[model samples]
Structures are given as C-alpha cells and as structure tokens.
Target: MTDRFYSVIYTLSGFAIAPMLVLAQSPVILTGVVEDESGAAVAGAKIALVQQISSQTEETTSGETGSFRFEDLSPGNYLLKAEASGFDPYEEVLTIRSQETKPFTIKLKVGSVKAQVTVTLDDEDEVSTSESNTSSMRISNDLLGALPTDAEDVVPLLDRFIFPGARSAEGTAILVDGVEVAEMDMPSAAISRIRINRNPYSAAYQSPGTGRVEVSTKRGHRSHYEGSLAIYARNSLFDARNAFAKSTPDSDRRLVQAKFGGPLPGRRSSFNVAAERLMNNESAVVNALTLSGPFTMNVPTHERRYRTFTRVQWWPTELHTLYATYDFKDKSRENDKLGGFNLPEQGIRTSEFGHRATLRDTVLFSRNVRNELFFTFQKEEQRSGSPATAPAILVKEAFTGGPSQSFGREKKETFDLADTLTRARGRHSFVFGGRFR
Candidate 1:
C-alpha cells in the first residue's frame, strides 16, 4: 500500500512540473538601453512593449545603468517604445523568437523645448513676411466633393470658386504636378488637390503676377479599382424667356464624362484614363418691329468638345518613380444666320485640336535630397474659315452684304526639358531648378 502511494505521488509531481520545464526551454529575452544624443545613459526612461498578435502591453522603467530587460517572453512581433523627460520619444519594431536573446539601443533626440529657435527662408517659408506678400488658397478633396460641378472640367469650377476680385480664367496658369499644362484637361474626379496662388511672385511660375492654379492628381495607392461616370443635360424647356425676345430661345446642352484608375498586377504600376464630351446648341431671334416684326432675323450656334487623358506610373523601388501622361482635345464650333428675309447663306466654322505627352522621373538620392527630371511635348492646331462658296447674310436697313471669304490656320509645337533638385540642411532648405524650352 505504501509503494502504491509513492508511485501516485511521483506521477502527480511529474504532471505538475511538466509545464514549467516546457516554458523554461523556450526562453526569450529582450534587453535594451536608452541613451540621449550625447551618449549619456538616460535612467528612469519608460519602456513599453506591445505584442502584435495579442495586443498586450508590458511596461518597465530603466535602471540606474539605463538598461531595461524583458525575459521569458513568448516568441512574437512586438513594438518597443521608449520615452523620457525632455527628450523626443523613440520607437522601433522587433521580433522575438523562442530561445533567442536580442539587444537594442534607443537614442532619443532633444525635444524642441531645449532649443527654441525658428528659422525662416525668404522664398520657401510660408510665414516669412519679407517675401512678396500674396494670399493663397487651398481647395481640398473634401471641399471639391462638396462643391457642385457640371462636368469633369475644372476651369469653370475654378472660375466660380475663386474670389470675384481674383477671378481670371484666361490669365491663370494651370499646373499639374508642378508642370505647366496648356489647358485644364484633367478630370475633376482624378484631382487630389488644387491650390490657387493669387498674385504670386515666385519665379518658377510662368506668369506669377497674373496668378497660378496648381493641381495634383490622385496616385491610386489605396484602391485596386476606381471609376466614375457622369451625365448632364439642359434644355430650353426649363429656361425663362428674355424680355426682348418674341419667344423663348431654343437651347440645349449636354455633357458626359467617364474616369477610371487602378493598380496593375505586379511591378507596383498604376494607370488612369479619363474622357469627356460636351455639346451645346442655341437659337435666338432678333425682334425688329419697325423692320419686319418677329422672326425677322435668327442666329443659331452649335459647339462640340471632346477630351481624353491617360497616365501610367511605375515605382521600381522605394527611391525611384516614373510617370507617363498623354492628353488630347478636339473642339469645333459653327455659327450661322438664318430665318431672315433676303438673307444670304453665311456661316463661320472653327475647329481646334491639341495633344500633349509628358514623361517624368523622380529619384531620392538621400533623406535630405531629391531630384526630378521631366520632358514634355505639345502640339496644337486651329482652323477657322468662312467658305468662299457661301454668300454673306444681309439684314434690311442694316447694310448690303456680299460674298465674303476668310480662312485662318495656326499650328504650334513645343518641347520642354526640366530638372529640379531640392536639398535640406540644418535650419535651411534649398531648391534649384532649370527648364529648357
């Protein structure tokens, strides 16, 4: 009976100590030291460890030697953070493995309280009053979404958003990613931000005195696919008649836009495409009671516009990026005089086509320096004419109009190469750039 009792007691002891042995064999130790920028030990530094999977946190304070240790930790990922008085916080990510010991050194920089000094640059610092005084406005993506827009075009939107005193649709220079674009052809859906610099004095701008419109497009980093479609229409049925007109003027306007963007599979690439079309028609009658009464003379006009844009981007590494973009636009307008007595056949037709292609590369030489190189090629053609075969329209008591012919055509091609380098040193940042056109 005593022998049996001894066997049972030994079995119970073995079962009780098995877990302790298993845990002891898988020991993990994490040791770290906290030091200031001067390499002096920082005692009383608070250290915290956060397990990634379990989200458990353990806290400890450094000893007199500025050393802290965590032993018998389970193997897992952890976030280690150190904090001390009058010093910036330090944080690092580390992994703990079973039966492994690792050591870390945490260096804390002096807090801003230690040195309270503000340095400003004339051209680069926004708060520097010595530079040319100008007001700037930023249009955020949230605001853009809240604002109403008729189509994907931003020119009209910008004109309406800017203050009345600062509004200048033609004088404002449009820039995309710091590059001047001939026109605002990018879709609104793809725009990430817009900045309006009123009365800017920066030499980098094309016409700083007039103003500048800077636009940034989305990079499509967060989403795998994104697209939007919009359609707008207006007709005379919902319009009010003018007091001078005999009847309501006939008018119709329509717009359609589509935009899509997403990341490509593999190689860290992305692409974006946008297309838009607009059509407008209007007919109006001039009331001349003394001449011939209502409908004596009529004017009709029609306009059509088509635009498309595409962009592709690739990131070969963390320090390098490349971009290619293409834009195309076609527009045509026709004006005719009709429904007038003894009126000759007359009309004016105008058409324009524009194309632009750009390539850009961005490289980060170091944490403090960056370089950007870009090339752009643009082509534009315009034609306007009143055919010789058509006769000029005439109005009673106005003047005798004869056959008239006029033709004009213009074509332009431009190429630009530019590079910009930016470097930041102690208390100063420098930007140097040049462009060849």
Candidate 2:
C-alpha cells in the first residue's frame, strides 16, 4: 500500500510540472538596432518593451553598435519605444512569436527630444508606410461632455463633428471596442472616446464610403465608484413668437440621463450602467398652397425615447481579460408628417426597439502575439401606423380622415463571431483575422 501511494504522488507531481517544462523550452528572441538618418549608429539609446496585456515593462540600452536584444520572451504583443539624445522619440507595436528570432532597425531623425514628442497608436501626424494618407479625428470624453446633445444620443454629435463634405451618404460604419455594430445608439455618458477615421486605407477595416466611427466605453476602476446625473429642458414659452403663428407654438423638450460605475467586491472585476429618457412635445408645421389655407394650423407632435447600457469586465489574469456588454433602446413618435389640414389620416405613428449584446476575450499568447475573440448578437424591431383600437376613417382632399392601416412591423437579427491575430517579424507587423456572421 505504501508503494502504491508513492506512485500516485509521483503521477500528480508529473502532471503539474509538465506544463512548466513545455513553456520553458519555447522562448523567443527580439533584436533591434537604433541608427541615425545619416546611417550612423546611435549608442546608449534607451529602449523599452511594454507587454500590451500584462503592462510589464523591460528596459535596456543600445550598445556601441546601437544593437539591443531581449531574450527568452514569450509570445504576445508589445509596445516598443526608443529615445535618444537629440532625436525625436519613436514608438511602434511589436509582435513576438514563440521559438522565433525577430529583428528590427529603427532610424532616428534629427529633432529635439526636449520638445516632448509622443507617438500614439493612432497619431494623426504619423503616416504609415503601408498607406498613402489617413484622415482621422479623436473626440475625448471631456469634449463630448461639453457638447450639447439631445437624449444623450451620439449619432447627432458625430454628424455635427464630421465635416459635411466628408460625411458619407450611405452612412458611417460604427465599431465599439473593435467590434462592428449596426447602429450608433450608445449613450454619450457611457462612451470614453470616439474616433472618426475618414477615408482610412488600412487593410484591417472594411468600412463604408464615409469611413468608420469607433467608440470605446469606460471601464470602471477597482475599489472606486462614480455616478452622474443630467437633466435638460426646453419650452416654447421662453421663445419669441413667429410672425405666421397666431400664438406661441407649443413645444416642450425634456431629457434625463444617469450613469453609475464601480468595481465589484473582489477578483479585479468592474461594472458600469447607464440609462436615459427623453420626451419631446411640439406643434407640427404645415405648408399648404391652397387658397383657403391662409389660416394658422397647429398639429400636436410627441416623441419619447428610452435607452440603457450595462457592461461587466473580469480580469482573471494579468495576460487575460473578459468582458460582456448589453444595450437596449425603445423609441416612439406620434403625429409625424400629418397633412396640411391636420387630419388624423395623415399622421404616422412609429415605434422602434433595439438590442445588442457582446462577449469578448483578450489574451496574450506570448510577448509577441496577441489574440482577440469576440461574439456579438443584435436585434431590432420597428412598428408603424395607428393604434389597433383607433377607428379608421377615409376622406378625399377636402379635409378630415384617419389612417387606413392599423399597424406595420419589421424585425432584424444578426450574429457574428470574429478572431484576430497579430504577429511581429522584425521591422514588419502583420495582422490577420476572420469573421463569420
């Protein structure tokens, strides 16, 4: 019985140690050289390799030959930054693969380092070697908050910010956290940043004619909580009367928004939730060419909208991240585009419901290669026409009438799964991915 117990213990130990042995055997190497524009080596240049997932940093200095190397690195994505005296700072994304040797040569241009140069992933000033030109704009959360918007909707804000000539007639492609989304219904209070890429030539994106709009949501911090509330109101009573109207046009608009976010109890998890409601009541205007239509006409209009968003994030390890998000919206409008006579038949009532959900996983396979896998599902439903209980009435061009149709409905659903892999080989960076819907 003692010998049998010893064999069982040995088997358990072997199972635990096998993975460690496998990881130790397949280390990679990263090598690079820093040189000047005049083909001269720049010695003593400071270099840093920051792992993208874990945020672990490794530093070294270039030798007399301007050569630097990092050995025994696992596969994953990293940010490589180099700084030297009398040269502009340089940074680029690097991907390393297991059991591979990657090499790079960085040419430093003549510039003042004290000027505080920064190279970001989406720097507008930097022209990528692979692409001819890129036009892009980034809107920060602070700027977004300062801008006035209705019902916390981001679509109108985007339309106002993008140049009229640059706007796409077909509509802009929207992406949230690198995943394509069908609509731009996310509330402004939940967004951390908005990036508009006009006429981007990157192979990674398949966008519409106008370009792409990328939105990133805020991730709550550990052990911290934040919340905000906003209320806006507008009334026609405060406005000056128009020359054509007999009395002040009846108009009222009210919007309320709330957002809250904080860390979960334990295990490096966080959650955020946001909700908004908007109500608008106004008098519709009619332009009638009829000789008997000189009198004033006031048609009551009403619109109501509600939206909510929730997100949860879990960081199981330094090199792994998981997140899930859900978004919902309901909107209804009444008395739209009624006839000049304000007849019920001309009125159109519409209601819409939208839902979106996403599940994502981000992992660092090594110091040089990173992978992002995501699954998304979306659904939308729309209804138009008068209420079923309302009586149908019909009349000729003379005057009053009710809608003939009681209801019309439409629904759409979509599902998508995507995988992206990034690999670095010396001076070249490669990105390849596949998506299914």
Q: Find the candidate with the highest lDDT and give its number.
A: 2
Model 1 C-alpha lDDT per residue in residues 1-437, reported as the tens digit of each score: 99999999999999999987887668688897888988999999999999989999999999998999987688888999999999888888988876567578889898776566543211112211113345767887789867776544557778654455554556567778667776777556667778777656555555545566777776654248988898889899988876755677788889887888888888488888878888988774544433344334446778888988888888787677888888888998876343333233345578999998988888778767878787999999998875577555446654324454557899999999998887879866577888899
> In every candidate, how many clashes are there?
0, 9
lDDT by residue (tens digit), candidate 2, 1-437: 99999999999999999998897667788998999999899999999999999999999999999999988778899999999988999999978866566579988988853566442221111112213335677888999887776556668668665556655566676778778776778667788888877666566655434567778887777688999999988999888976656677799999888899999988489999988898999887543433455435667889999989899988887677888999999998997767455454467888999999999888766656777788999999998875555554533454444454546888999999988887767766687889899
State in Å the error of residue 305, model 2.
0.7
Deviation from native of the Cα of residue 180 in model 2, angstroms:
0.7
Q: Each model's TM-score? A: 0.62, 0.64
**Model 1, runs deviating above 4 Å:** 1-134, 145-153, 156-170, 285-298, 336-346, 387-407, 426-428
RMSD after CA superposition, every candidate: 11.1, 22.0
Tell me the lDDT of candidate 1.
0.73
Question: Each candidate: what lDDT?
Answer: 0.73, 0.77
- Model 2, position 6: C-alpha lDDT score: 100
